[model samples]
Target: MDLLPSAHVDAYPREHLPPRDQWPVLSCDLPSLAYPDRLNCGAELLAGGAPDAPCLRMPGGEVWSYDDLRAAADRIAHVLVDDLGVVPGNRVLLRGPTTPWLVACWFAVMKAGAVAVTVLAAHRAQELATICGIAAVGHALCDIRSVDDLAKAEVPGLRIATYGGEASDDLLRSAAAKPDRFEAVATSADDVALIAFTSGTTGRPKGCMHFHRDVLAIADTFSAHVLRPRADDVFAGSPPLGFTFGLGGLVVFPLRAGASTLLLEQAGPEQLARAVAAHRVSVLFTAPTAYRSMLQLPGGHDLSSLRRCVSAGENLPAATWRAWHEATGLRIINGIGATEMLHIFISAADDAIRPGTTGVAVPGYEARVVDPLTITELPDGEPGLLAVRGPTGCRYLADDRQRDYVRDGWNLTGDTYVREPDGYFRYVARADDMIISAGYNIAGPEVEEALLRHPDVREAAVIGVPDESRGQVVRAFVVLRDGLPQDGRTGTAEALRAFVKEEIAGYKCPREIRFLPGLPRTPTGKLQRFRLRDLE
Candidate 1:
């Protein structure tokens, strides 16, 4: 891969990209993915809609026109360069719930030619600090309600700016004084636009660097060809913009199609149903858990407005798919995407879908089930590792784990799958110790690390257990220190759960904890996690 001339003044992101030879095979066979050398995705996405067309809508009946969003993004871009001293390639951290203003901030970062590092609002101080440290973040744009956690992160010399607040120094207040028109930076298509972080089974997060062109490649391949979104569609979802699944469904896909989206800050099963009916949302993106829960809602919901439903972040069971189609005449599109690949690569929609399979590779992508050791393609009906390559592939930020993810021009997603004779990829199991509970990825070792921080815990092991609601739930087996009260086990379990919550995100906390005299270990002193699963 040849390099393109960059417009970035600060070159940290580019300097940290993995060696070009280690990158997965990238393809752009589709006509829509042939982007120009000097492209700004922020300006491109805002180009199609009419000036007065609705671009963003809130649950409270507030709507922002295309012109309104463009102007706000332009003003914020000016504020980034002039007020915050931001230059191209500087990593700017964005921490906020899903809202119109958060989307505007993302566009502003792109327009200013800076790399956006979007972390979830549920991330705590330790998680935020780890991400900021890895990305070398110097500035943060945080919502007023979510500023406290970012403020507690130990990133020295970090410049923090708050938004959606009445403070005099708020980001929106500063933008109010700036002009509503600014020229977007003429960045190369290969310039880093965002660095999304994903947890590894090793209990550390890896930064996935995606180029400016990768953002639009997802829309061209999956959204354009498969989802077939129309300009009149109204998108709504429960994913926060920090996750790529949410970012594409809520922001990129709709904006690229010149459609409108309803942003919800707190979307539970009931809240999602009400908003869909009230706003007439036609397209929805959420996990299978949400769909299952919505089906059990009291008196049911008026989902007649919905035409398309997308399920990702975790596997969609055949039972859930059948139940949803039986209730509402809409077929749920199931996709499997990684933070490294940016968005979905293998998915099916409409008549092409199979109940239990994850469909064939989307247009412009290739997938195969390969033997993990030799990378040889496996025969039909044989379970092996799932490997894929496409226009957008894994590019870790200078991590040695790059070799583990990308091998022989293919990205090996740590999933075990079996390919049917007809080419449909069937769902199997994860080959790693990652726990997918209610659409969130929880690393077992990471949760175990949090549990070990307690003085009472002598040893601990975490594993994912099957659940009816969530696909899987985190369960922990702990060996306490000497002389602990054995009769008060129930109270100790509650106390341990509360202790773990303070150290990490509440969602990663173990739902069930069982006391053990000793964790299963080998003679070589290595923990045997397979024994833990057997105990479950």
Candidate 2:
């Protein structure tokens, strides 16, 4: 087997990768996990599948066969190489909604042997700038709808190409001049394929580096063993392609099984149900909050075509699960996954599911509950930190916080959980200040920082408050500058919310703003988040 042509030795992704000693030990016991040393995941995922089979069903009733997707991806790969001067291992930042073109761009990056750095479509310029800077992204493919944010990011020397834009900016136009067939680069199994930057407890996000092998590993492990799909199945989901959860559910899992996926730009509760009905989708993946919201929708959405529904990104409340089951006669398959590990590590399908518990670890993965302080294994039924290790595990890119996440050999998923005697994992709470609201990870300090940017706010502290619909909502406690009108409470709160929305993603803005005389702090001056939760 011939090795892929090497990129510059000074590639930032390779240069900034964590030292060998810090990487979590990878394991693959499944027969499907046996992959070739010279593997191109894009070739495996896009080119070598059933080319004539239906692969992507667009929102407008247009269908694309596997061959169609492959041809587009190959052309895009050529565009990257010839038009954009992209070399193997160059970091290509992708910014767009989850559409067929975006999916095609992702596969194209993989086929070109470039590392894909995908950020959520909802991210503002500041977030985009921080991520691009951290990942050292030099080239970008962005949707025209999102090009404004990319331009606002002002990344240095970033070569920008547009897709879903005007004729002059369209990537497809560039690719039209190129051949529609391309041979994917044969890269080593351990080569970094993509960088998924997940939000941290602090204000910054940490990039989790995954390999070509890890790309196939998640599909072989969780998707293969747990959420098994047939070639006839059509998958659809809400999470953005930037999130690993969305990437796995929409792209990897379906494509791995030679199935098709329906890409939806907006997959809220009502829209999701409509998509299921309109597309006759067979497999559904979304967060728990979406399930709860859909359960409240007026009953005209035909969901009889859906055989499976997957819930993740946050805990599935037993009540919400039962409600969804009673409404649809389908038990939502609950799972727990992290950006670091790439996809779901624990999940149960159909009859094997227990209402409140995240079922046993998926085949090819191992998990345990450990004492948060000592890092020692804890007995079942005792709440402690959840540690997981498998073919995919934590690999932070040049972040010192890697030491806190990976201990010994286990990836401590900053989550508190209790394992039942039957091997079921029950979610307790988050071990850190990071808040999971409506399936998006919102750092409290990040919200506080946004709020503080407002002139009217003297001091601000943000925390997650329990909510039935959103799972949690961001609530801010603020000490306001003295001159504000007390009678204008409604106006003031809305003003602060709008102000924060300008600085950050609208989803992270405070849903409720309460002006307080002072925020609760410890004697040592540490913000007492627990105390704020009690007030809620």
Candidate 3:
């Protein structure tokens, strides 16, 4: 197994320590060789060497090796380029969860030298229409489940291909007769590989353009330093292929290490644990929330094969980390990754973790805490906005919001954090969305964490609202367990509110609480605080 050592200096053992000086600088200008440059890194690794190695495992229980993956991609590349007449740099839309077909289509689009426009697999017809309209996509390859939704959108010139089995029954027969082997298409480093949708909490999602170099940057840096993979390891995760976090976790990292990845149809906790045992998945990349629920499963599932479990999408709480570690011996790797930055900025190794902190910055990136309003750097242990600058910088798709997000080469994620003296970062909250009432600054996450501790509360969201008395008191919107009664005595919404008061502080106690069927979440399972605020 490849030992990807700690990027965290203080956390690193004396034997595994990286050079103190000249270490923070990134190794830019990645290898350039091949247009539609293959967007998914898994197949690109096959072209680089390791041809026959296993690469993808679908939920239906089929394994496709790297040679198989590349062959499949090339065959489709021929169809997409020759039969469909797709041009280099043209946008070819791709949608669905992590299935072998989704993985194949992603690379096939890139191998054809077209930009892979990825949309959330969970997106409905209206969402698909809006994205296709914005990107002017003329072609799409989606799963059978999402094909109906994509078809519902009356996108002119839009051609769609289904990926439940074959492109169609006729194509399946032809592919079976023909011997499968294909050469990769040459793509330029500067050529666009992917246009991923950013989770627009407030409004419409924006397409973030990333280059082939940007796609490989994570493999060279974070993957090399953090998730050092082995040939025997099998990768799997929940984030849909549309999100960069999922793309990197399920495809890029393992392929860079010449390993296999589990491309599941469903990655919910139960399915994920089952996939782990079935495929012998060793490395997991998912959210902290999912890990917490996995612990609640009857007795604990066999995760013994798992060597690493990465948590992202939101801050990984220490409490959640403790619960997961106690249930399964596997330590959860925590990090903070945004769509724009390409991959994780800060991450911790299983052995070198401080539960609450988001590890140290990756070798290629420089991170610091800054005043949200002033944009000035803050001292260690002081709470401020987290600012980062690195090789993989934020490049939006001609959006005016770029000016607000990127200033002086620093990409400002609207998140609050504190830099520990030892270089780890502790997440505070989202900068703008924090709740403040009666001269007290309260992070919504703090209260939500306290609420999730209640057994009856399945989910909770905290938001500040206009109040006549307290001037924007903390209000919590909660979702009770399905079996639990909605009645006041049984569901315990009021009791949970009181519990939060005791767990946190009297001032931070939710002034009002309401029970709902479920909390509104993004396709990635991130709580939509903007929508929650609207409910108030």
Candidate 4:
């Protein structure tokens, strides 16, 4: 209940932490939720575990044990401190596919007492620059294939190092010469551990600052109480590690439970099913869209190994849940979570799962439905904004938007929901411009800003339109700059889309672009996204 003093003196992350008053009130009432003031999550996750305990299993049949992971992380941490001159509380950016090495790099940053800034591998040069600049990242451990984009980000004085490459300059090679064992930094529970970015409606990324304790809290609460994963459970999912959903489901939860994760660098529906069958994955974490697609997979795919399936990212439709149960006789565990909160805070496991609703709050957390305008608690069955306060809550780093996310000790998750008398929360529509497609959160303004970068586009408005397969796809209504030939309409649209893909991540690019004479706007020029949705 009290703040813990950090051990690191540099504390660059502490300097940028939002003012104390703006922080969401964190509560840990459950006995299982207890955490120490002086803690290092990496040490807790990897140290003192059985040497032969399986920690990670790659799709290629390669497996790493708890001891192996710790040794690898220790080597990388030595490289960070001795070779890269990294100090405690420094922000280290990680950009790579979801591989065992990337997970090692993640723990390595925390082991060295540095804050991990995980960036999605799909991000382009511009998006990477914005994130690095906002976090003031000074060092990056990047995948060799991503070197070009990292260079294009153009952050001054940014020390670049390579990982997962066979080159002599790769982090793996440099780390091999280091000792096998190193002491994990003694970071306080309240010290910043990682900065995960979520897209803002205003076209900027908001870095959600999480503490070292918050990481373990989710594992103890959600993964422990809800999913109830055992040490032998093998976790696998489609979400990129950059997203908290994947970081928790694929890495933190498994590591905390002493379970192994079958890392799928590029897991689509087919790949997911195959991975599950091949690796005998016990727990599956993926979005509802993937669930539907996996159901459509041709016969003879043995998913019998899957005992528990968790769906999040986008709202889980009751139909998808029923379909999964019908196909596999295994109920899908549906939960809702945000990057700010780390992972699923409200989820039901096994028989507690109620179809069509995001189940009761996981132990150690509290949730309520509140009127969006007044922030007053709404009666059961009345849909309004969802507010939650628990061990893990929103803590935006040095951003004034912290005031918008956390108010009156509660984090206002920008989601419309209804709480039933039975305490099950049902999802409604999002209260913002965020579009959850497949499993990625794409902000409409961020995409519009990317489209605006094109020379031929004067104005652009991006909105999420319903799609059967992807949940929601980015659709753009563009106002082409005048004086264009009438026959160039098709070419211009395609060109604008390509230009946007070049500017931002490909997934954020508008899948379908329509030329509009003018966009619907108020007298003050405020965009009416409702009208755009109506056009769909």
Candidate 5:
């Protein structure tokens, strides 16, 4: 792959991108993915729609119109260049919840031709320092409430600016005095726009670099084709802006469609439900766990306004999908995506969705099940590694693991799946999450689905634990519905075990069941099975 003439003055992110030969095969076959050489995604997204139209909304009834958001972003971009001495391609770490101001900073970075490194507001000092160090971040734009931990990170020479505060030096306060009009940098379409770090479920977090065009590519392919957002639709979800899932669903998709989205700072299942009904959210994006949890709420929510529901971050169990449809009469669009790929590559909406299987590759992408070692395409119905290539694919920043993720021009997503005869891909388990117990190959998610079918089970996580006789045995951690009996631990465990045995093969049933208040999950609602394995 030949390099594009970079517009970056700093040149750090581009220099750190994986070697060209190590990059995954990137395809831009879709007509919509053809972007101009000098592109600024921040400016592109904001360029759509009438200036007076609503763009971002908050739970408190505060709405920022397209004009309002652009003015704020333009002023912030001026502050970054004039006051902070920032140049194009400087990595600016953004730490905050999902807020209009936080989003403004993201666009500000884009307009200034700087790279954005967005981390979860819940991250501690160590995690923050690791990310800053890995990306060689020099400046940070943080929310006042979450600035303390970032300050404690103690990255040397890391200049920090606080937003949403009363301080005179606050980002918003400084921006107020600056002119609300500035020219967006004419960056190359291939210019690095953001570095999204993985959730670190397996081990050390890897920074996945995405180009400016990649940001719009996801919206063009998945959101345009599958989600099919309308300008009148109000989008809302549980994921924060730090996660690509949220960034695409809440920010990129809606903006590309000239729609509005409600940004929630703390969106749990109950809160998400209330927000949806209160704000009349039509498009929803969240994980399967949240969908299942919302179903078990004591006083049911009025979700009649919902027109589309998307589930990702983890596999969607067939039982949960059926239950949601039965309760809401809406088919949940289930998909599988990776931080490396930036957003979903496989998904189907409306009548095209097949229960339990992740739909075919989105229009601009190609997917196949392949042998992990040899990279040979496997026959349909056989479980193998998932290989994908599309308008967006993995491009790790200065990491040796890039070779491990992209092999033979294909990105092996480290997920095990089976391609049905109809071409739909069914998730088996994560490559590392597969359990071999007593010579039987078992998938943890399969067991989890069977357990979720039980009436009392609110949430479940299955993992293989070491056992002297069987080499490894299935262990399940369950969270029961509220008001369920907690006194008879033995009786309840036995009954749940019996239920699972009835649902799945007796050999695949969990031999050990432990009840818990809740399962360990990332901020994005992905079950941290590695943490559960550590408990054993």
Candidate 6:
């Protein structure tokens, strides 16, 4: 097809449920599948491909080539197996943003035949301890700065792995110095590869166990139909590598497509824009909040290099899409994926996209709105709970909610959506996260997306709070941009509220805007609505 250099990265080398050929199908379902299920991952990169392509380009233009990445992975692989006493099926708790070291640690874990449980770098010790306890993580690969906090966490007998900057890591260097030749351990398709934790605005957290097949499944679904990538392209983004969103962006998607990845250690909308301008990153994966942030930045950031953008972790409203197109002539491909689904299960090409709708189901998955209680699919164009399923499935580790989630073969993501007559899926709200005030059923995200449309608002989080008078009232926690309007008395806050009322239904508008420095967020780019509720 003669695509761009960075766009040629591999996806699912082979599609399973749909049975694809061009895609590389990785399966641990064999005698040859390596233990720790290593071969099922970037170990293939060891077999020779894109050797000189940039794997990771950081602040100093310190880019690591695919060859360098593989060698580094090999060293870490040896350390994992020979030093840390890691074996097949053990989970390695990894916490960090996307960087060459993070990438190396990921492949090295898988290369050593171990499953990687990615903990959002933003997770506090309590969250970390909870994940380790749930996933049975015995070893941790953490950033040096955060190792002390992690050490204090309740991961009994937890082995520690530390790295120094990008190149100055003795721990990783010792591992990376090993012979660049090591065979991947045998593993299987159904074997868990990652325990991704996601929170419902209310609960503690649930660990979504994804199989090796699920790793390729997301690409099988989204690549051909949505944000397709090619070799020679460089994938980079603000979503932390710990989240599946970033895992797919900085590693899986690019590796699956035979492309390199650029990992940003410190990522925010501003930092991402500067990095994008400097690196000419081709495919960008982030949230709508970051997109809006980039638009407010001064013009001429040289974003001419961006070709494809994918938005998830939150609903992508119409205004954000327009703002992106106006800024870069690129439409942000909006996708809605749950940690349970591994990655974006519903998405569409920007050209084929419908602005507010999350888009149609991916190539290998089925999406339908259903009555949550009845467990039956709803008629077309009807709004109901969104239940989905695919060949690559989700199994919660030791959670009783498993029965509640997967009913009669359908993975009921706790979300409500309306399926358009034309097969598109529109975001409604999380079934349990919906806010009911008096007679109005308010979707927090709907109101939040509306608030983000305002120029002065940097980010907004909407949550319903208890109110005896009108039932539950919608409250918004807003972070103003660099140059917010002055006049606290009746100016900035009042203007934002007015703007929200104009953008959305008056009933759905936030009753009050509480200016804050920043909205609470998880590492993967999901705004923590739970925190918004706590602010009350």
Backbone clash count for every predicted candidate, in the order shown: 0, 0, 8, 0, 0, 33
How far is 37's C-alpha from truth in model 6 (Å)?
A: 12
Specify the highest-lDDT model's number.
5
The residue-by-residue lDDT of candidate 2 on 256-320, one tens digit each, is 99999999988877888999998899999987657766765675689999998998887676666
Local distance difference test values of all predictions, in order = 0.88, 0.83, 0.73, 0.84, 0.93, 0.73
Candidates ranked by lDDT: 5, 1, 4, 2, 3, 6
The lowest-lDDT stretch of 10 consecutive residues in candidate 3 is 5-14
> RMSD of each candidate?
10.5, 10.3, 8.3, 10.7, 1.0, 7.3
Q: What is the number of residue pairs that collide in model 4?
A: 0
lDDT of 5 by residue, 1-536 (tens): 57689999999999998988888888898899989889999999998667999999999999999999999999999999999999999999999988999999999999999999999988899999999999999999999999999999999999999998998898998999999998999999999999999976567889999999999999999999998999999999999999999999999999999999999998999999999989999999999999999998888989999999999999999999999999999999998888999999999999999998999999899999999989999999999999999989999988899999999999999999999999999999999989999999999999999998898888999999988999899998999888986443888999988998898899999888888888999998998887887885
Model 1 shows how many backbone clashes? 0
Please list the residue runs of candidate 2 whose C-alpha ends up more than 4 Å from where it truly belongs after superposition: 1-10, 433-536
lDDT of 1: 0.88
Tens-place lDDT per residue, model 4, 366-397, is 99999877889999988788999999999888
Better of 1 and 2 by TM-score: 1
Per-model TM-score versus the true fold: 0.83, 0.81, 0.87, 0.82, 0.99, 0.87
Residues 213-268, candidate 1, lDDT per residue (tens digit)?
99999999999999999999999988888889889999999999999999999887
Candidate with the larger TM-score of 1 and 3: 3
lDDT-best of 1 and 4: 1
Runs of candidate 5 exceeding 4 Å displacement = none
Per-residue lDDT over 421-519 for candidate 3, one digit per residue giving the tens place of the 0 to 100 score = 888888889888777798899988888888877767766778899988778898888777668765445337567867887899889998888778777
Q: Which regions of candidate 6 fall more than 4 Å away from where they truly are?
A: 1-39, 45-48, 165-169, 199-201, 449-458, 479-482, 486-488, 491-504
- The better candidate by lDDT, 5 or 6, is 5
